[model samples]
Target: MDAVGLSLMNEAVGGSEKCVSAVREAFGAAEALMIRNVSQVAKDFRCCQTPKDHQDQVELMQSLADIVMGTVQYNEESVLMSISDLCGVMTNQSAAYNEEREPYQRLVKLSQIYRSSSEEPCLDVSHEKRVKDLMDTTVQSERRAERQWTYQTCTEFGFYQTCEDASCPFSGMVTLRSQTEICLELFGISQNSLPGRVAFTNRYYGGDEPHAHRVLYVNGGVDPWKELSVGNRTDGGEEAESVFIRDSAHCADMSRGRVTDRRSLKNARQEIEKHVESWLKTAQQEKKRTE
Candidate 1:
């Protein structure tokens, strides 16, 4: 009886091993079949069947089977539902690729509509109107003029301030030339005597004037009295006010020898012109000296 019982136990063990091996072989075959189906579908859709693509699809299908077979657990019903959803997505993507001609035409039409709509309004506006709109905002004018100035000046300039007070003009130009010059000197540009640079003009005017304010001519460009503020809090919590302070100092020093000693709007125009000419002359002399 003991020997018979031992033989029966051995038979049961062998049967279990065979079942496990069969299941593994079946899983591998099912995975391969899924890959083959996906490849055929991709080929029909004229998409490239790359090795990576095949591997991805095989893995996906195997994961799906594992969930279905309860080899991977968490909600078996949810896994089954997800497999159906994946099939729907694949079908839609396949359809989109297969009917390529109509979709391509629609895309081309949409792009044409976008291009036409974007360009037509811009072209419809008159040149004068466009210029007026561009200049209407003080910030816009400042931004457009900024690149013409040096990087330091660009950083120093600020937006225009509007005044509704009848005593004041619609716009007021604030001079920051003194600030800029001081900073330039500190940077070692004007070591000996401050180089003669153009003074910026500040103007306040109201009413119907074509040129509401006079912009000073400097280096073949206009210089308006605009204060540019710069500096930021450093990591060490120290404020580097040297940049603005130096610029203001330079401006004050240069203002001393000017024909008009005042900082008024009228003096600003004359002084700026004189300073500009001085700067040009100095530049030419330096060039000749170097040559």
Candidate 2:
């Protein structure tokens, strides 16, 4: 998900000239990705690919705007009026994206067109330009909020949300509120600049969907984020494997060992070492072949 690129946009607006170019390109890439995501789901997200109908698209965008605004503090409605307007721009961009995908998906061709104005294509270049510009604006605004949360309150904010949903040892709105005040004192930002609580809470939450064949997923049962992690539904097999330590802290296996380390942590680390060595063996064989 290009998390590094996303984090680089933390300066929000009026950053240094270097950040301006780097963030611009990074956001441009993300805007393309968002378009691809919406395209995969379509305007209504029903997995339909019919691009001719766009009346309902505007409403879908309004719903997204609602989701985006729901994360901010309530009193900032005045400032949100302008931010909400970017939803329309996103809608237009999504719609324009359809023009470049007729007969068959020419996403690559259209992407090239988006990258360079001089590239010739079988679609409206001017419309493509407009979509690109609007996407730039839309991405910049969303990323500004993301950057604020990333640099300021990401970890505690996520755990705080987990506490709100379930009992968490590190969870408490009091900490969040207190930290918000501290953030304001330390940095000139406010809670309003952070991404919505929903987005924040789901930051590390993922489904049990299958991943790479050799990938190893380690989860600690007591880990607050363990409530959501890859499943250990199957017995050991050739594909993906998950090692879950019910009593261990999150990511405890990755930490350097200590005599006081819990049994679960020790077991998890051994499993990790075994898997890593196996992967290295496979990689070395592949390298020998390539050589």
Candidate 3:
């Protein structure tokens, strides 16, 4: 998520001074490693291939780099681990592999890194013992949830975050086409079908303009997902409330109340609590009426 990266870079807000310093330090170290891995991959990939082949390799490298940087929940240790994995995978290549197998090998290693780092396992890996160790042997409790979310992406949500914008910290290689390739490979969902599916989802839910009652919508100003949420009620029909937590990260207010939490997040949680209290009182009154 571009917004996640931006939030990490915001020295003035989002996190406490110590947390922010640690994040920046970890991110900087990881970024340097990732860039080196990219450069090495690029150098190896420069063997006179066809134009299409070159483009494909370039895109693949970019997609892998994006994964290293685009993890939604950024923990300092996790960032360091991801970059370490990238560096390990890139440098662990054997001389036995021919040029043709290089890309496939890289794909497997990158997929392993992604799965080990994220909630959902993306590409399946069947490679070296080192790589196999990266994936947990035991099945995750969230397997079903991850699969359901993947299915949603294929059939409805299509919430693919690509680094296409010029200001994005990741390489521009992460295009819409590159992002959707997984849908085709994993779920047989074609890229052509995604736009329609996403449209249907937005239409069905009213795309942040839903006709609902007593609903409280909350979003963090620095979270990119906020763009898809109800910022303001346009129809002026339903009295839906939306609270924007300025200078906060995703779900910052939902976390346990911390001394390090910004003032905006604390206030947002108070506002949410007020709404919940009001709703409880209204429900009690309705029950009394029915009785």
Candidate 4:
């Protein structure tokens, strides 16, 4: 998700080092504000004592923090656009993109409000109302797919993008505990069971060192998820290949070839095509041998 933000930031700034630093500072400020709001909300929730059980209060905090972390993903278009608008303003390119854009205007208004008050603006989300709204909404097919994916994460793959690492660009509020608590809440999968489950999955599938043939492991340099993907295998026994596109973001090679694409990305796509062609030819040869 941070990769999405970084890619979008680079696009918006267009190589302006000044705008890059300014946009990073702006993102840090936004993260700080969100952390402050979540902290205040947690304190208020604990003190309110609205007949909720201790367990329920803890679950609510986890859920709320999960919501806050969701804004950091690419699914939240508004957050991405806000950052893009901030970048545009810093680079003096907002008018070039859209003269009628409202994001910059809204950002300006928000800045004005922040300047006028001694207290920082807080985003106060009503927990009860939020829960009610979610309950009242109808679940769609896309949401069903999401539920299935979430279950896989809880059961087999603990692929949670947490901010526990010091190098993570996001705030520390997005912890592994906050993510694991969701599994407990939804599927009765405790945090304690996650390690064993993930280990079993790795053992079953040979996680990083899979014994395979004609497999191409392609990854983008800027993509955070690439850390989990198979890179260069030292054994060099399998008919597998790895291509590292240093200038690309997530799934960049999956897109249609563009004239503006970096040379590394273009070469990577060609390499993937070569792998596919070789696999098809190998399959044809095996069919002839069987016949």
Clashes of each: 13, 1, 0, 0
Q: Which of candidates 1 and 4 is the stronger one according to TM-score?
A: 4
Ranking by lDDT: 3, 4, 2, 1
Compared with the true structure, model 1 gives a TM-score of: 0.16
The list of candidate 2 runs beyond 4 A from truth reads 1-206, 233-236
TM-score of each: 0.16, 0.34, 0.61, 0.64
Q: How close is candidate 2 to the true structure, as a TM-score?
A: 0.34
Task: Name the candidate that leads on TM-score.
Answer: 4
Per-residue lDDT of model 2, residues 162-204, tens digit only:
1122222111222344334333443455666545643544454
Q: Lowest summed lDDT over 10 consecutive residues: which window, candidate 3?
A: 123-132
The residue pairs in collision within model 4 are none
How big is the positional error of residue 100 in model 1, measured in Å on the Cα after superposition? 66
Q: Model 1, 42-122: lDDT tens per residue?
A: 332222232244333433332223222221111112223221232222223454535522322322222233334343321
Model 3 TM-score relative to the real fold: 0.61
List lDDT for all candidates, in order: 0.29, 0.40, 0.55, 0.54
